[model samples]
Target: MGKVGPPITGLPVMPSDLPLDEVPEDVLREVLEEEKRIYRNRSYKKKPYPTSRDVMEAVREALRVSTRIHPDEFPDVVLHILESKGFEVRHVTVKRIWRAYETLVRKGVIRDELGVMM
Candidate 1:
């Protein structure tokens, strides 16, 4: 009777001492395919900066309040309001947030309380 052992998965096992040039074509093809799959998936899943709608709403609110208070210093006013509200606001962050707010307003995705001319 044959000894029952671990099920064979049919995957090729590369010898540690085997040089890259000596690797079998099928095993090399499998490795390349896996790498390509990983690369494609990595790119698909990679998001450098994901926009947060909550933050966008907060920015719009800040804009509305700031427009009433001081229209010229929208970014600064937004920064102040967000900071006072316990949000970590930076000068650059305020700029980006305000830009996103304007984009949404232009697209009519969200309403502006005071309304934006452009």
Candidate 2:
């Protein structure tokens, strides 16, 4: 009878101890590309994340509710007040809020000092 080898353990596991350079170039590139794609998608999703329209609405509501306090008195404070007013504060990111203020000021929708637009 022919000599038989001992039963083999399921497929040999890749040793993590081995240096990465030994891995094939194609394998390495595939892994790197996968990671790059994930990052790229994440960034793309975040681009234009905060829209100007949402900020405008938030500013409008904030000012409308806080009639006694001026919008220019404390911008950040007004933001918190607006949030408490039940406005979707998440839509009003810092960048968006700033843009909204700039647009309102430019278009004369709201004044910087008068507290309300003319």
lDDT of 1 at 88: 51
Worst 10 residues of 2 by lDDT: 44-53
Looking at model 1, residue 58 earns an lDDT score of 65
Best by lDDT: 2
TM per candidate comes to 0.39, 0.36
Clash-forming residue pairs, model 2: none
Model 1 misplaced stretches (Cα beyond 4 Å)? 1-51, 67-71, 110-118
| lDDT per residue as tens, model 1, 1-118 | 3333444786554454345676699999999999999998876442123236646666777755654644456667655655566655543475586677777778887666545455
Compose the digit string of candidate 2's lDDT tens values, residues 1-118. 3333444675554445356557799988999999999988877432233245655766776667666665455467546756665555556556656667778888978766433433
Candidate 2 lDDT score at position 110? 78
TM-score: model 1 vs. ground truth: 0.39
Instruction: After the best TM-score superposition of candidate 2, give how far the Cα of residue 45 lies from its true spot, in angstroms.
Output: 17
